[model samples]
Target: MLFKEVIGQESIKENLIQTVVNERISHAQMFQGKLGSGSFSLALAYAQFVFCSNKEENDSCGACPSCLKINTLTHPDLHFSFPVQILGNLKKSDDFISEFREMMISNPYSTEQDWYGKNENENKKGIIGVDESKELFRKLSLKSYEGGYKVAIIWLAENMNIASANKLLKLIEEPPEKTLLFLVVEDLEKILATIISRTQIIRLKSLSEVQISNQLANHHGVDEAKAIEISTYVNGDFAMALHEVSSQDNSQVFFDLFVSWMRLCFKKDVVGAVAFSANIQKLGKEKQKAFLLFVLNLFQKSLLGNFSGMENVKITPSHKEFIEKFMPYVHERNMEALHTDMSQAYYHIDRNANAKILFLDLSFILFKLIKK
Candidate 1:
């Protein structure tokens, strides 16, 4: 995505643009930000500007061969290393290049969750293992095919294990000539201190609510009032805000399913709960995740509705009725446990865990919590 296409972060964009203009680019830099903050987009745009055959003062010339290649994320000199699960014996990042390319082309603001959904692996932990790191080292060792800078983007770099980080440390210490490394991470503290020291850090702040709202209104075709409400609910997570807008149709379905699941669990209806789990198992990994997220989001709203107010809660009439009745159950005693259970379920689902067992197990936990 071009700098212009990415919403907000104008100052960050200008700083990135000026890096190339001044010709003082760092060989290794970390673009650290929260999920949906557009760190990847910034890195991609920066790489595009660096490799642009006809570079403009503010952005890359989109018509150039280099620009076109980078836009599609197929640039010969551009390589990506991201978290991936072991499919059979294959754990290589290169194995999922086509999907990765398509995903970014469609949504540059995608998170690790999005990547997990794309691969449809059940709760399989995506990591940058030592094997993948060695592969990256091999790829970066080669000279740039186009006779320019080679860009290596390590998406979710914090997912790298110790061995992988060590291997990457070697490369960063003595990187190939004309090579630039972009280590994109969500959590800074998780990364090895040595690795952090080796790279220049560029922070991408989360988008403001207004920025996210405008993006939803203009691009997602959301009405202003709805976009503003969604933005507030999302609390500046553009990826989630966009997701909520795009998946608006599923809102009611998720709501009804959640209510049913809670009722089954609360009533100790094992047969009903098992059947519910079976149905959830059939919804595929992404929808399963969306269901969990929907449930968690509602719990958050209900908690607020119980204590503070529903000023920020965005939902339909059915959800409103449910929350109005359910608010008392979502107390301080159970809110944390409820959120933790659902969040952990979401995480496990991304890792390709068994959905039936997971959902049923979560049902038991919810039953105990709801009893409180």
Candidate 2:
């Protein structure tokens, strides 16, 4: 992944290049970013640039032997460690090297859910187990194969268990000569403080709306209307944009659910809302969070529909028709309240709050807000 190929993050690319030029490359660094924010891609590109024999000022020369190997993730010196499932006495990432490479090739934007889809078994959770730490130490202990930097890119490093994190502390603090550690993290808060203290942190933030829109249109071949609409709803999350494109009907699914729930609330039918809540609770926590985001995005669209200023809003023609009807119910008085309540619901859902009750309470709130 060359810097030119990775979309957006121009400033970050320049900063990373400067690090190489100044010979200030840190031994241990964490590339922390939200899922789908191009952190992984940037880190890989940076590593390739660091290893490239014919390095240009802006990017690595892709034709170089080092660039060729790193591009395929087959470089003897470029290593990766990510979350892996414990497969019947198999605890180390080495056991699933082929699957890992396949995943890296097929879907670099994947989160834990995608990782689970690839390698998890029996709904088992993926984690960086303590046993893998020993394996990590062993791999890093070896001399660089090509007499270049031994770079270890630890994807999803936040999943490391406490014991594993502790074992990595000493190594990160003082790595072997010319060794580089790239810890890619999604959930920054979950990482251990001790581990964080040992490494230089490179923060990656979300992309802009235009950047995301172009990404969708260019990468997924998504139509202009949908690319615009999805870019609006995804809040700069590239993975969510891809998911929205793949599951365009997901919008309609949420639309149907939203229309039904709001109708129940409009009639002030607590009984109906409670039953709806019960049904929503059956969708599980992850789906519940997705639904909340869908609703929040819909709220923005609906609010814009209240007036003739449709240029600022992005929605399908079919969705615009419903928004035309629903617009009167959403106003400044209620949209803020709705956003706050819905965002709060999403937060609580992450912490394992009772879904049924939470939805029930929100239903009543929506009932009153709709009438306001």
Q: For this target, which candidate reaches the highest TM-score against the unseen true structure?
A: 2
lDDT per residue as tens, model 1, 1-372: 678987788998898888788889888999898768888888898898898989877888898999988878899999999999878777888898899999989888898988998888747779999999999889889988999888999999999999999999999999988889999999999899999998999988778878998888888788876676566545457887878877775666776798898788779888998899999999888778767876887788888888886666665654678788888889898888888888899899989999999998988787778864
Off by over 4 Å in 1: 249-372
Error of 2 at 14 (Å): 2.7
Which pairs of residues collide in model 1?
122-351, 122-352, 122-353, 123-349, 123-350, 123-351, 123-352, 124-351, 124-352
Candidate 2, clashing residue pairs?
none
TM-score per candidate, in order?
Answer: 0.70, 0.89
lDDT of 2 by residue, 167-283 (tens): 778778778788898899988899988888887888887888798889888877988878877676566678777778887876677779988998898998989988999999998
Single out the weakest 10-residue window by summed lDDT for candidate 1.
Answer: 228-237
Could you give me the TM-score of model 2 versus the true structure? 0.89
Whole-model Cα lDDT of every candidate shown, in order:
0.85, 0.83
